[model samples]
Target: MVSVAEDVAIVAFEQTPSHAHFNDSEPAMIMPCVNSVIEQVGMDRHDIDFTIAGSCDYLSGMPFAFVMNIDAVGAWPPVYESHVEMDGAWALFEGFVRLQSGDIDTVLVSGSGKCSPGSYREGFSLQTDPYVHAPIGLDPRTQAGFQAQALIAAGKATERDFAEVVARSHANAKDNPYAQLSGDLSVDELLAEPYVQQPLRRLDCPPTSDGAAAMIIARADKARELCDNPVWIRAIDHRIDSHHPTLRDLTDSPSVRIAADRVGLHDGPVDIAELTVTYSPEEIILRDALGLNGETSVNPSGGPLTGSPFMAVGLTRVIELARAIRNGDGGRGVAHASSGPALQQNLLCVLEGDG
Candidate 1:
């Protein structure tokens, strides 16, 4: 495992519901979450030594848009803050690293975005290679279709398997109040639906959503004082693969494998795993990469397939798994986050609750 000078734990977390159209500014959506997490930890805003956020400027159709989001965290107090052009999960990664310095005691982390007003597919195409993928409009959905086809061609999975993932995700989402889509869906019923991208049906994709999530993390000693049931962060590691899809094995995620190894994911029995299965086929790839078995409850919060708030989706996975561990649903769990196209980048966070 990655050794640390001092242990860190997530003391509190909050998230807004995934909305099809929030009809408001990004700050408006994020403020509530920030307030709720601060309240949960019973701390004043100034008590947080650092604050960081993650978001995409391309999605908002404005440059330096993340600066305006500071309104949600408040700037009048001149807080030490930072921003990442990636997902909020990356912000959490930075926050975790900052606490390791021992100079800072606490960090407030958040991620928010509004995909409703923008062309979700077109906006994300910018994340692709400008010399090839972007010009051809090879968006995430198209790439996901390619992944699904690769899975079938390799005989690793079938359409039925993809449908089953969707069916299970929607079913599990029923218990998640923040999920945008949830219901009883049969695998056969899902397979019958027309394909949005060949081999991948409509149900196999995530709904475009706008939402926000925030959390408070502190050093081990401060965490105990902040909350009665602190979820400890065991280890965090991230890795990336090639940007070109052709250079990679679509059916597998080597980055996830490396991160899992670095985090010592299989060091002990894992009670749950919250993976960033934005596409149904990704669930299979992630499952195989993480080497998780039936004993582990996967995506109990429904995962991104039910409601993808882009920037916030990955961080929400951490919050969901932390919530489960805190509720005594599990003693230890893993939360996975992904960025770039078709899981080109992956982050893993191992969490455990005090016995």
Candidate 2:
């Protein structure tokens, strides 16, 4: 339970519009966001004390693919940098930890992905255990279908409930310019649609998207100098559970609950929560696990169900939370991210405006 030596806050954030095909390289997709955040704080690439990115090479069907993305952040001056194969939310976790050392005043964190070029079903199969699941080609959506089915069997939720979640997500997305899917739809209409997987329909899933997001975190001292409204990072905690889907209780997300506790989620009132609801059913599990009440605005920006860009989706959750706090939508909020099948791993970040 170590803590950061100095307070850190998100001073600026930026992201590219989610697109099915970006018509650009990963570096090109990431550069504008990187530039936007840096410009927001009136800093140059070299001015960033440390830079880290989160992305998956498997999506691009290549190794060391993240190396090329450094061009987006620039390397001419040789800055301290690193990369993670997970979502950018995890990269943000590292940046938060690095800032805790009190040696660096600023860090740039980013995540990006393009899912249009390859079969996500095939690409994601590699994440499964090679001996057991990979050989059988178990993908994320199929795993989610199992989770949705479990929720039904456990009587925790119903197909109508899934449709309702999708309906609400679309309604919320209408106002989100970055959202790829939006508009009003009825729950009955959604339920009548054919199922992509039993208990899950086409609308129950996130859109296949290509996108990138970046943010700047500054130490408390530097934060006051960086921006007028700095969304303070109150706490961040991430936990993982059994990776094998069969070993988990798909009806619940224990990792999320644990991370929430570690971050003191129940210690205060959460005004908003931006959850990574890639699968509509996930919202149910997350809401219950996080102990969120109806008063807590959930996914006001439509969440990943509107536009999911794989590695970038998790980080976008963090961006959304910061945006809410900055825009006077809320005073305090939580951002949640999940990786692996059926919420195998979860990260929770708590943020607050100036108190």
Candidate 3:
């Protein structure tokens, strides 16, 4: 439970658009973000203590997707590095752990995914329990619909409540050039749209997106040297809920709530919160569980409802949260990332501008 702010800090942060399409190949787009980060932080590629990344090929329809991004780092002279088949938040978690060892002064963490090339529903269905759920052919959207109905039945939420969340997200995305979907909608209009699934609709879910992002982490003194304002990590933690839908409560995401508290996200009211809730209704469950009220600025950048690129979604939340703190956009904030059906796995990071 040792916080990195007592030792390390986030010096630089960068990200690409969370859009629905890109003509560029995976590596082609990824390197630009990496290079942009390298230039912004005023560090040579070799100066990076270690490099780590996250990616998955199933969505990209190409195996070895992560291997292609290795070139992005100019990782010659064999800079120490590793990768995860998991989301970039997990990779970011690994990078922070390495930084905590007190040997390396800095590290770089990045992730990318292009989910626009194929039938994403067919693609995402594959992440389900291979034996039971896959055979049933349940896609993420449909599963979310089932969960939404259950939430209504449990009286935790109503159809109109979910629409309000979507309306807010789209409106918030208006100022974010990176957001894929932006609009001003009222609760009635969002509710009137036909459901894409029983309870989830086209607007409630994220479009398939293509994107990448990178961040720089440095020890305390080095963090201050690299940037006038450094966002210090107070805590980073993650946890998992049971994977089987029947075994869990779809109305509440225990994993997200627990992870947030574990990271001291509620030490006081956070000034900002970057949440990766891809579907609209999932936002309600996450917000309630984390004890957030109207005061906490949630997803000011529009979040994943604006765009979702599979494995890259989680890391983008972390990067945006760091940037908000480092740029004087906010004073204290919590970065919330999620994965799997109904927020099955979650990561919470608390960051502050103060050293």
C-alpha TM-scores of all predictions: 0.99, 0.98, 0.96
Summing lDDT over every window of 10 consecutive residues in candidate 1, give the lowest-scoring window: 68-77
For candidate 1, write residues 232-288 as lDDT tens digits. 999999999998999999999999999999999999779999999999999999999
Between 2 and 3, whose TM-score is larger? 2
How do the residues 1-355 of candidate 2 rate in per-residue lDDT, one tens digit apiece?
3365789999999988889789979999999999899999998778889999999999976789999999998878799999999999999999999999998899999999999998888898889899999999999999999999999999999999998899898899899989999999999999899988887999898888999999999999899999888999989999998979998999998889889888888888899999999999999999999999978999999999999999999999999889888889999999999888878899999999986
Ranking by TM-score: 1, 2, 3
Per-candidate total of colliding backbone pairs = 0, 0, 0
> How much is the lDDT of residue 184 in candidate 2?
96
lDDT, residue 339, candidate 2: 88
Winner by lDDT: 1
Q: Which ten residues in a row have the lowest lDDT in candidate 3?
A: 1-10
lDDT of each: 0.93, 0.92, 0.83
